[model samples]
Target: MPKAKKSQAKPKTKKAPQKLRQQVAALPVRLSEGGQIEVLLVTSRDSRRWIIPKGWPMKGKKRHEAAAIEAEEEAGVLGTIQDKALGHYRYSKQQADGREIGCRVAVYALNVTEELADWAEKGQRQMQWVRSEIAADLVQEPELSLLLRKIGPP
Candidate 1:
């Protein structure tokens, strides 16, 4: 009897890490004065780095709606979305409990009409408005900078 031929199989592709499944939302807002496209940045709760006004999406809300809400809560700004998405980016966040989780953020452009210094109600660390180009440079994640560039300055 002849020996059976040996079988071969291809290797499977590795999946992305589950720790990379976090979702967040950001908004690109412009000042009404100089018509300059500006971004609202916030300090992390741990004071680690400066970043955009973004957070986990609330249950039962669309991504863009969550982006708008995070903008209002973190930066104390009220605005209307332009019905457009700026882009997306990914990064890592360290929670207060010492857990580091990867995060993905969806960005949107908003036409801001007001600014209030009342972020305490939402438990934000700090907020500031910077020129879009400058703001893009300030973010720690390279993907976010690229997204900002794609959105362009107002």
Candidate 2:
């Protein structure tokens, strides 16, 4: 009987981990007449999901500043933006080509003082002001929901 031939198999190679893209977002907020925290949410252009205003970093602007700019453009709100980040959340963004990219967003709290009647994204998106607790329920991101919950009155 001929000796059995040894099997030769190719070594398995691990795929490289996808890099997480960095972004800045603003959590627009205001105090209701009853002194309750109200969060301003904007509908995403493509999916129409409720999400905070976010985008890539802008030139000659700090992280928080860029976040504020995004808020103005996407949500049509303006106010004092905090320098420090409230927290960060990770999400997968779907691209036009059907690829999902990993992203990490640094959230800054923006106390909205003014809302524009006609803004860049006014017609493109719907804006809503809801109680913090309700806003938490309205959003899709878990970490962002937790952040919204933290801003509610004790």
Candidate 3:
């Protein structure tokens, strides 16, 4: 029998969470007619988890501006995004190869000015405008939950 050749697969290396990848999230909010704090959340593309609009860094744009871009693409929100970040949260993001990467998200408040009748991701995901307290409860990430709960009406 001929000897089998060695496999060419590369060894897997684990990335350190301490050097967590940076991400930006848009916390789209608006005051309801009742003067209550209502936050906009969109379902994740694959997992369908309740999450704020977030994405990787954008070229040339500032962090918060990139976050605003994510909000527009994911939730159909047009608004004023605060220059300062409200807070940060860490979560494990599932990768294509069944690995979870650590992501540190800077949350920026977006005071919604207009919600489009139709936006980029209108049909792929479900968007909801719920009370801030309710948003805190719906998210699975504990740190995100705390962040949302602590965020006052803006």
Candidate 4:
């Protein structure tokens, strides 16, 4: 009888680039007054969910600068850095053509100083200031939720 032939193993293939790996900046603004803390929340344009202001980094702006810019554009609010950083979170955003993109967002704590009546990029589904604990619960992303808990009530 002929000897059995040895089997050969195939090499692993490289993964394709995921659609969602874009760099973005986000600010978590918590407003405090008279011992009460509130968080700013913005409803996304698609009206599918609520989230904080965030966007892609601009040509020359640093991440924090981009975060401030996004806040102004999305929520009509001007803010200053309050603490080092709340933390980071990852989520998926859907594109126009229905493609799901993975996103990693770095979040910083900001103290809001002003709220402009007009926004550069209008059409946010909604905007509101909710209590910190409620705001944390309202957000759907797990990582963001965890960050909020870590920051704790302000």
- Model number with the top TM-score: 2
lDDT of 4 by residue, 50-120 (tens): 78888887899777777888888888888785434467788988889997889988776667878887888
Question: Candidate 1, residues 1-154: lDDT per residue as tens digits?
Answer: 9999878777788986666664656665775377767777777667647777777778998777887787777677777865456777888777789977887777777667777756544564756778777877887899988776666544
Q: Which consecutive 10 residues in model 1 have the weakest lDDT in total?
A: 117-126
What is the C-alpha lDDT profile of model 2 across 1-154, one tens digit per residue?
9999989898899999999999999999899899888888989999999999999989999999999999999988999999999999989999999999999999999999999887787889888899999989999999988888887432
Tell me how candidate 3 scores on lDDT: 0.93
Clashes of each: 0, 0, 0, 2
For lDDT, the strongest prediction is 3
TM-scores, one per candidate: 0.76, 0.91, 0.88, 0.82
Off by over 4 Å in 4: 1-3, 9-22, 28-32, 82-84, 152-154
Quote the positional error of residue 120 for candidate 3 in Å: 1.6
Q: What does the lDDT read for residue 13 in candidate 3?
A: 88
Ranking by TM-score: 2, 3, 4, 1
- Residue range with the least summed lDDT across 10 consecutive positions in model 3: 11-20
| Superior by TM-score: candidate 1 or candidate 3 | 3
Q: After superposition, how far is residue 148 of candidate 1 from its true place, in Å?
A: 1.7
In candidate 3, the residue pairs with backbone N, CA or C atoms under 3 Å apart (3 or more residues apart, or in different chains) clash, namely: none
Q: Each candidate's lDDT (Cα)?
A: 0.72, 0.91, 0.93, 0.74
lDDT of 1 at 121: 41
